[model samples]
Target: MNATTDLLRVDAVKKSYGPIQVLHGVSMSVARGEVFAIIGPNGAGKTTMFKVMTGEVASNGGTIHFDGRDVTRMPAYERVRQGFGRTFQVARVFRDFTVLDNVIVAVEARRRHTGEAVGSWRNCAPSADIRDEAMSLLADVKLDALADGAARFLSHGDKKRLEFVIALAGRPSILMLDEPTAGMSPSDRSDIAKLVSRTRKERGITVVMTEHDMDVVFGLADRIMVMNYGEVVSTGTVDEVRNDPKVREVYLGKEMVSA
Candidate 1:
């Protein structure tokens, strides 16, 4: 896809801390409604890139554009306002809150002004309309039956699903999922993969994902980006990436390429 038409473009981005530099002129593009996967060994700057894109961490150099607007200096909340939603590698939900409450909290935050969207939903339980909407979001993820249950009581996989529901409630145009299947079982991975697929199909949201599971990445990604040592080694479709010698050497390794 052309850079001008890309839904998201990270150009020549760089990041540093004290004397250490993490990202080195990294650049990539994601088209609208595409599943773009970033894969690399740990500390390869995947999380740092996410942090920069979501506006949690400032970049030392380069620019970031989303849907044709410059957002390099935009705050995290503003990115959310710009229809960019993200799920952390770890599932983050209200421990003391119920499943429905978790979704309501996200919905409330999504609708409220930036600064006012903090704390639990307990102080401001959702209205009937929001409750119904939150329930619908839960149903979309097949978690409606557990709406009243405490989030702390849910399993890891269930909590991940809850995260997806919460992200859906916010109505993100581009969803960023970091390590979406980090600790999941095969079944759980498949389920979450399907959920991501369905989100793309049903909502037409562009999905930017970082997953270690090759099966999930190759299976779901319309384009795959391989990172090694804070640089992009390859960016192409599955077949193109699979056959790239640089990818096979730097990212995939001999075992995986052979597989």
Candidate 2:
């Protein structure tokens, strides 16, 4: 892909927690409107990488560029405003609020900046546009019927789906998800997978996700990046990464290699 077309670029990025290093000289780029998957075994620093990208966890070294601007030191909220959005491994929701309300809050945050009231839900002003957009986002995630329900009452899978909708509320150019299928049953996992694919297809949003499920990674990724010991071991189309000996030795292991 052309460097000019890349939406996000991470150059020799490194991160540490006190004396321990978590990411070592990791570098990669994600093009606009592409589905990019980062896969690894447990403790490969996938979540830490996402946090670094979002500026939730400060990196010890390296540069992060988003939409051609350097954002390595930008605050998390600032990153969100710049069209980068992410979902956690664990669903984060406003438990007491209705699903619609949760998304409305995010939409309001995305647009309101500071010192501005989100205003009454029934307000007829243009600010009410957030509510309309939030409701539309809920419908996109197949949660239109649950719009009035308390987020705490949603099923685990539905809550994850709701979180996806909330992420969309920001109108993000790039959506990063960490273990989106975690804790989901097989059927629910399939449902979320379909929802993700639909989001990419219908909205043309770029997707970057990390997953432990090989089937999910292989089935959904347009391209894959494999990381080990905080460094990217290899990255390529699914088949190329699958055939890489270094990836096999570090991640797939000998038994799978033999198979």
Candidate 3:
């Protein structure tokens, strides 16, 4: 991909937790409208890398630029405001609120004044425009009928689906998901993958994901980056990565080589 056209770029990103260095000079670029997957064995620093990108943790060094602007020092919420949406390893939603309320809250957050949050549902009901938009998002995830149901009452898979929709609530330019399908059944995993693909296609959003399941990684990602011991070891298309001895070694790396 052309450097000029890249939407997100990470240059020599370094992070250390106390005396332990977690990410060492990691660098990669994600082009607009592509599903880029970061894959590796546990302790490979993928999540830390995700956190760094999301501004959840501070990086000791390196830079992150989005859409021609340097966002290296930007705060997490600022990053979200800059159109970077993220979901955690464990899907999170408002357990106390209804499904529709959960989405309404996120949607309001997206359009509200900067530094102002839509805190309580008690003070006001969403306008018709907000409700229409929130309900539309629920329908996108097949949760329309359950819009009034309590979020906590939904099954794990449904909760995960809701999180996906929540990420879309802001209509982000880039969506970041960490281990989206972890702990899901094969069928549920497939559902998430389809939702991801649909989102990318329909909205033309760039997707950055770190997933444990090789099936989902290989199935969803347009390009793959493999990391090990806090360093990026390889990056390529699906076929290129699958056939790479280095990636297969560190990723399926040690195991495949040992076998």
lDDT (0 to 1) per candidate: 0.89, 0.88, 0.89
Candidate 3 clashing pairs?
248-253, 249-253, 249-254, 250-253
Displacement of the residue 31 alpha carbon in candidate 1, Å: 0.7
lDDT tens digits by residue: candidate 1, 183-233: 999999999999999889988999999999999998899999988888888
Cα lDDT tens digits, model 2, 125-196, are 436566678888888777989998999999999999999988988889999999999999999999988988
Q: Please report how far candidate 1 places residue 1 from its true position, in Å.
A: 11
Could you tell me how far off, in angstroms, the CA of residue 55 lies in candidate 1 after the best superposition?
Answer: 0.8
lDDT of 1 at 247: 87
Q: After best superposition, candidate 3 residue 115: deviation in angstroms?
A: 12
Candidate 2 residue runs with Cα over 4 Å from true position = 1-3, 113-129, 253-259
Ranking the candidates on TM-score from highest down gives 1, 3, 2
Each prediction's RMSD over C-alphas, in Å, is 3.2, 2.9, 3.1
Task: Quote each prediction's TM-score.
Answer: 0.93, 0.91, 0.92
Clashes of 2: 0
TM-score of 3: 0.92
What tens digits encode model 3's per-residue C-alpha lDDT throughout 179-219?
99988999999999999999999999999999998888888
